[model samples]
Target: MTTQAADAAGSDKLDSGVLKVAGVVVLGAIMSILDITVVSVALPTFQRDFNATYATVAWTMTAYTLALATVIPITGWAADRFGTKRLYLLSLTLFVGGSVLCSVAWDIGPLIVFRALQGLGGGMLMPLGMTIMTRAAGPDRVGRVMAVLGVPMLLGPIGGPILGGWLIEAAGWHWIFLINLPIGVIAFVLSLRILPKDKPQPSESFDFLGMLLLSPGLALFLYGVSSVPGEGTVAAGKVLIPALIGLALLVSFVLHALRKEHALIDLGLFKNRNLTISTTTLSLFTVAFMGAMLLLPSYFLQVRGETTLHAGLLIAPQGLGAMLTMPMAGRLTDRIGPGKLVLPGIVLIALGMSAFTQVTADSSYVLLLGALFVSGLGMGMTMMPIMSAALASLTHQQVARGSTMMNIIQQTAGSIGTAVMSVILTNQVLNSPEATAYSAVTQGQVPASQVAPAVLDQGQSSLADAFGHTYTIAVVLLALCLIPAFFLPRKRIEKAPDATDEALPVAVGMH
Candidate 1:
C-alpha cells in the first residue's frame, strides 16, 4: 500500500455512529454509578424515616455492592449467550424497575432489598457497555471511544452528592431514585433506536462450578472490606470470619479456573502481556486514586468545616481537570500508546498528592484546589488510557472476557483501597488528641466557641495532620503504579493477524 493509504487506514475517528452507541452506554453507566453516590447522601434521611440505627440503614449501600460483585462474574458469559444488545437492554430494564421499587419502599428493609435488585442490574451494565463500545469502535479506535465512555465514570463521584442533595432538599428523598425514571427512559429509547442487533454465540456451556465459587467469594470478601469502616478494624469477627472464608474460596476458584478451559472468568487472558501489565497498573492506580478521591471531600468537610454540598462542589475542580485532558489523552493513546501518557499521569498524581501530605488546618483553598486540578489532569490521562491499552490489542473473540476481568479488578481494588485508607485515617484521628477533640466539637459533644482558641486551632491542625498522614500513604501507592506502568506498551503495537489468541507475542517497540 502507498504511504497515503497506510495513513488513511490507520486514522480511526470516533464518528457519529460510534458516538451514538457511546451515548447509550454512558447513560446506563451514569445511572449505575450515580445511584451509588447519590444514595450515600440519603443515609441520614433513611435513619429518620425508618427509625433505624445507622448500622441498619448502612445495608442500603452494602446490599447494592454485594449484589454487584455477585452478578459481574457472569456478565461476560451472559453477553455471549444472550447477545450484547439484548443483555444490555435487560440490565437497563432491571435497573429502572429496581429504582421504581426503591422509590416506593415502605421501610429500610424493603429499600435495601430493592437496592440489591438494582445492583444486580447495575453490575452488568459497565462490562457490557465496554464490550459494546469496544466492538463498535474496533481495535484501532478503542482509545478515543473509551475516553467518551469515561466521562460519567470520572464525574459521578463529584456530581452524585450535589445532585442528590439538591433533589432531596427540593423534592424530598424519594426523588433521589425517581430522578432515574427520566434518564432511564431516554437511555432505553436510545438503546433500542441506536444500538445494532445482537449476534450471540451460545455454543459454550456455562461454568456452573466457577459461579458457585467465585461469586460468593467476591461478595464475602467485599462485604468484609466494606465493613471495616464501620467496625473500625479488620479483626472484628464480622469482618474477619467472612473475609477469611471468602479468601479461601477465591483461592480455590483460582485453582479451578486454571484447570477449566471456559472458566466463569477467563484467567488465561492474563497471558496477554499488555493486558497483564495494564491490569496491574489499573489495580495499583485505582486503589490509590479512588481512596484519595473520597478523602479530598472529607478534608473539606472535616477540616475546613464545609457542608456536604460544598464539599462535593469543592471537589469539582478535579473532575474539570480530568475532562480537559481525557479526550486528548484518548486520541494520543490510539496513535502512540498508553505507556507514554500513564507514567506522566502517575507522576502528576503523585505531585498533586504531595500537596496533601503536608496539609494544615488552614491550608490555602487556592493551593489545595490547584493541586486537585493537577491530579485530575493526571487521572484523565491515566484511567481510560490504561483501559484502552488493555482492550485495544484483544482479539474480537476475547473482548468480552477481557472487559469482564478488568471491571472485576477495578471494583475489587477500589473497595480495598477505600477500606485501607479509611482504616488508616480513623486510626490516625484516634491517636491525635487535638483531632479527637475536634471530632467532639463537630459532633456537638463540645461547643466550638466554648473551647479555647488555642485548643480549637490545635484541634483543627491535628485533624488536618491526620488527613495528611493518610494522604501520604496514597502518594506512596501512586508512585508504586509507575513500576507496572513502565511495563505497558510505550509505542503503537501491531496486532498479529493470527486468529488464535493463545500465547500472543509481546510487541515492545515503535511501529
Candidate 2:
C-alpha cells in the first residue's frame, strides 16, 4: 500500500477507537436515565401492588431523586481521588446491584431503599460519562462527541414511558428493573476492555466540610421543590422550611468555596464568559423543556383518555425530530459556534410551545404531533451545543468539576420546573367553575366518573382549561430563556491544553 493510503487507514482506526469509547459511555448513560423515567409510568401500579397509600408509594420516586442530589456534589472529588475508570465501573455495579435488589423487593420500604441505592450509583454516571467522553474526544472534536452522547438524553424521556408501559402490560413491573441487567453487563464488560486506565490523584485532599455542606443542602433543596407538587403551593410549611434551610447551607458552602483554593467544585469557573452563559442558558432550556414534557403525558392520560402505552407513543415524535436534527446541529456548532444555533433553536421552541397553548379537549392530533416535533428539533440544536460551548471554555483540569456543576444545575432546574408547573395546573383545575361545581356535587370523594354523566363532562372541560393555562406558563418560560440564549458566545473558543495528555491516554490492547 502507498504511504498516504496507510496513513488514512491508521487514521480510520483511531477514529473507530474513539467511537467505541463514546458508545460505551452513552450506553451506560442511557440505562441510568431510562431507569428514572421508565419507573414513572409504573408509580400507580406500585401503589396497587404494595397495597400502600399514595404518599407512601410516592416516596419511591422521592427517595431516588433525593439520593441523586445528595451524591452528585461529590462525584468530581471521587473521580479525582479514584481513577475515572474504576469509579465508572463501581458506579455501574452499584446501580445494577440496586436494580437486582429492587426486582425482588417484597415491600414498599425495601423498594424505596433499593431505589435510593440505585440513585447513589445512577447520579455519578451522567457527569462522569460526560467527563470521560470529553477527555477522550479532546477539545477539537468535543462537539461531535457530545452530539453522539446526546442521543441518550433525547431518547430516554421519550422512550422510557413507552418501554415501561409495554413491560407492565407484557411482563409485569419486575421487568422494568430486570431490563437493566443485560445492558449494564454489556457496558461494564466493554468498558473494562476498552477504556483507558488512569492513575489515581492521591495527592488531592478530600473536602469534608464542603461535602457536608453541599450534599445535604442540595438534597434538601430538591426535596423542597419535589414537595410543591404534593403540597400544591410554595407557601406550604413543608415547602418553605426545607427550602430555606437548604438555601442557608448553600450560602455557607458558596462562601467557604470562595475562600478555599481546593474546594470540591470550583465556583471560580463561572468567571469564563462562555461557560457562564452556556450554563445559564442550559438551565433555562431544561426548565422550559421539562415543564412541557411533564404536562404532555398527563394531558394525554387524563384529558385525551389515552392508555399509558399510547400516550408514550404519542410523545415519540419529539424524539424523532431531535434525532433528525442533532447531527447537523453538532456539525454546525463546531464550525460556527453555539450562539448562532441557539437563537434559531429557541425561536423554534417558542413557536412549538405557543401552539400548545391553543390546545382544547378535541384539538388536532396532527397539530400536537407537529408542535412536539418542532420543539424536539429545537432541543437537538440547542442543548448539546450549549453544553459543548461550556466545556470548551474550561481548562482540561476543570472538566470534571464543570460536568458535575452542569448536571446539578440541570437536575435542580428540572425539579423547579416540575414543581412550578404542577402547582399552577392544580390551582387552575380547582379554581375552574366546572371543577368547583363538580367538587360540591362529589364532596371530593372518588372522581366524577361514578357521578352523573354531566358531572364527568364538567370535570373534563375543567381539566382541559387547566392544561391550556399550564401550557401558556410553559411558553412564557421558554420566551424568558431567549435572554440567556442571546448571550452565548458566537465563535468557537480555543481552550488551553492543560491535561489533554492525561485525558486521552494511550490505547493499550485493542487493535
Give the candidate number with the greatest TM-score.
2
Write the residue-wise lDDT of candidate 2 on 97-136 in tens digits.
9999999999999999999999999999999998888876
Can you tell me which runs of candidate 1 are displaced by over 4 Å?
1-11, 444-454, 496-511
**lDDT of candidates 1 onward, in order:** 0.87, 0.84
What's the number of clashes in each of the models? 0, 0
lDDT of 2 at 338: 86
Query: How displaced is residue 51 in candidate 2, in Å?
Result: 1.9
Clashing pairs in model 2? none
| Residue-pair clashes, model 1 | 0
**Alpha-carbon TM-score of each model against the true structure:** 0.93, 0.94
